[model samples]
Target: MKQFPFFIILLFISSCQYFEKQIPSEKELLQKELKSINWKEVDEFPSVVDCEKVNDKKLRQQCFFEVMAQLIQEKLDIDTLSILYPELDTIEVKVTIFPNSSMKFEPQFSKDSVAYDTIKIDSILQARLVDFPKVNPAIKRGVPVKTQLILPIIIKAKEEKK
Candidate 1:
């Protein structure tokens, strides 16, 4: 009978370790979660009011990109970029959208584009690209995040000579 009681005490002492699990600190848990996340991709792309109604993720992204490109094209059409650089048919623009809904547009030029006046083109783009429709910032893990997109804008289409 005494041995049975001793065995019970030993079992209880050994089982205490199974119940005593070391809880991780909040900071440690947060750091671990952050490490597991892929920072390169966002859950949702930055969008305009028109694209917000889109339910499909891929379609929504496409709508946002299309709208942005169209808006940029329209805005630049009023500028003299085509006249300034007749040979330049396309311009690669780097667009940065902030979490606060503000945006920045920068022209990307190739290394061989030394003949083009990059400063003037950049100034024209900066001056022309403004007052856009309200853009909802990208979402990552349910939080608003800044995102950047590279879009190619057609300066002017060549007319086919008959």
Candidate 2:
């Protein structure tokens, strides 16, 4: 029958749309992927040779921080920061680790810290914080990323004179 053929043709044409894939544009796909990603956290924290062996993610991160703090403490111990500011027992250092595995360190001082000579302290830190161990940059979705952290460094030990 003619009506039967026409109905089949209409059904076939309509069904073709169901099979047709609506391929997304690259930009749309990229935006969708970006939205799904958690920007606040990294897949992997930055690491040094000593921390690479740790299996647990949290432990590895802790190891990296500890190693970094120890290294910084050792480097600054040789400086005369303690003598310059005997009252200053601790200083916060803002460390920025780059994707290229380079690092920068800056002293973080409070706004009310007008009594301390910030410029002199900054210069001393710059002069002292150098020659770090090889550091691997942080990873996010398999890509290396830059990370910033604030580390509290003890400048002077409390002297208990008996």
Candidate 3:
């Protein structure tokens, strides 16, 4: 019977520690507040790229591929496209449109070394489109708003020498 009270006290101490660690820091609290703002509200559709609304899904997919191609070309600026690996040389970029009037972009590569090499040269862009800039205000939305986007770029790395 005496051990019962000690067990309860131990439980209380452990629970108290857990709650203490869960307390949000000031920065986290502020970020949550900022994210809660009504940034997705829109009176009209956005006017970024030229396309018909009837084929939004199809057109968006094509547009994303086009954008990816453009970014790839930009990356290869002033450089000749060598036959690095005819069988393995390839890149893919994906753009995801969100229901919340936002978009996300991602790039994936078949070769893991390509991803690693990209990070080594430009650590900021392992799966990121360093060429694409932030969407301009005019192209973002018809109404004043804020949105978050993610873009990824994948590149094929050359085989290393022994």
Candidate 4:
């Protein structure tokens, strides 16, 4: 029987390492680049008229909020409400802007004092919002997104001391 040299066998075994393949196990497939993400926050906030020109994100947000507050303050008949409901000094409205440019509002007044009828306030709010111009909605990943804004309005009586 012909005998093979042990050195030649070692050299052949070493050369086989070049063809060795790396087969990833199930762990590689199960591992994720990102385990979680924040979907609630939008990349851009809803912009009001004339606020689109602002480029800085923080400034844009500020302008948006300012414009919205101004619009609501100008449009709503808060003075009348203050005169009618002397007890309620503050009110909160939860406004939501949808991607379709439509808005939804939920008015919240002080329930303990019961100064004014909420139904009447709700109706007045709805009518006032009708005059508000449709605004550009928030954006997320280059897509328009729905956003919510809480507006707190303080209505003081005309005779009350500051």
Candidate 5:
């Protein structure tokens, strides 16, 4: 009968570890969670000055794209877009917005693969890009991240009669 009491005590002591709290500290916990987060996707995408005001997630994304397109078009100086010839219906300007807010400009034709004035286009784009403002980078757990943006500029010579 005495052995029953000792055996119960032994069992209780052996299982005591299971009841102990193993909770990590706040910093440790955050570090652990950060490690598991997928770097490919972010909580918030990169945004410009105007797009930052939007509250909705999906709407913010759309605003970001729209604002970027508008800004690029404005910077292109459509008034003098056709210095060589003013007969073309539209001029396609492809620009890449880097994470650091730097731009890569590629002016090319949509259908016809013709040689372009790379130097002039690069200079114009460089000046415009420098004049433009930097954008807020994408965020993953509040950390800023790099992103890519492509903008296409099309110039129409005249409106078609409808």
Candidate 6:
């Protein structure tokens, strides 16, 4: 009986180690992808006046990446809504750019209250509005410049039910 318990413990440990070996760490994956991209810094975007200053170039790059990720997420949400509600009529999606390079995605259904869905996307969108005639040129030192584009998603139903 004692042997049986020991054997079970051994099996569990071995299984865990096997699974751990199979799953790659996030850092490893990110490094691999980063290597593939020919990264180019964006300088055309106007400096963000409100955000706290970043000290290093790497930090700035990371910040821009975060913003881009958020923007992509918002786009995905819009695409998902369109797919999910093909019959939906007059779907209005509100997209806003926050000061900290974030996006708020809110889907408001004017016709049906049940269809309303609010989604907040943060830290994933790069600054859309760049202040020209920059207040702080130093803030733009290493920041990747990106244009902010907002697309209000409105999906209308083809036919209304009487």
Best by lDDT: 1
Off by over 4 Å in 5: 9-35, 79-114, 158-162
- Please state the error at residue 68 of candidate 6 in Å: 12
Regions of candidate 1 where Cα sits further than 4 Å from its true position: 157-162
How would the candidate models be sorted by lDDT, starting from the highest?
Answer: 1, 2, 4, 5, 3, 6
Global lDDT of model 1: 0.93
Q: For candidate 4, lDDT tens digit of each residue in 63-152?
A: 887787777766664447777777766678888999988888888665474646889888877877666776889988798988898887
- What overall lDDT, based on C-alpha atoms, would model 2 receive against the true structure? 0.91
Residue-wise C-alpha lDDT for candidate 6, range 100-144, written one tens digit per residue:
444444444344455434232212122322222222222233553
What are the per-residue Cα lDDT tens digits for candidate 1 across 1-162? 869999999999999999999999999999999999999999999999999899999999999999999999989887788878989989999999999999999999999999999999999999999999999999999999999999999886334213
All-Cα superposition RMSD per candidate: 2.2, 2.3, 15.2, 5.6, 5.3, 18.6
**Candidate achieving higher lDDT, 5 or 6:** 5
By TM-score, the candidates rank as 1, 2, 4, 5, 3, 6
- Evaluation by lDDT, superior candidate among 2 and 6: 2
Q: What TM-score does prediction 4 earn?
A: 0.71
Per-candidate local distance difference test: 0.93, 0.91, 0.46, 0.77, 0.66, 0.43
In angstroms, the error of model 4 at 3 is: 13
Stretches of candidate 4 off by over 4 Å are 1-35, 110-113, 156-162
lDDT of 5 by residue, 1-162 (tens): 989999999999999999997888999999998899897787998777888778998999888877776776666554454554455434455555455656565655544434555566556656765466777777777766666555565543433213
Q: Model 2 segments beyond 4 Å from truth? A: 1-6, 158-162
lDDT of 3 at 153: 30
Give the 10-residue window scoring lowest on summed lDDT in candidate 2.
153-162
TM-score for each model: 0.92, 0.89, 0.31, 0.71, 0.61, 0.25
Candidate 6 TM-score over all chains jointly: 0.25
Clashes (N, CA, C under 3 Å) per candidate: 0, 0, 1, 0, 1, 8
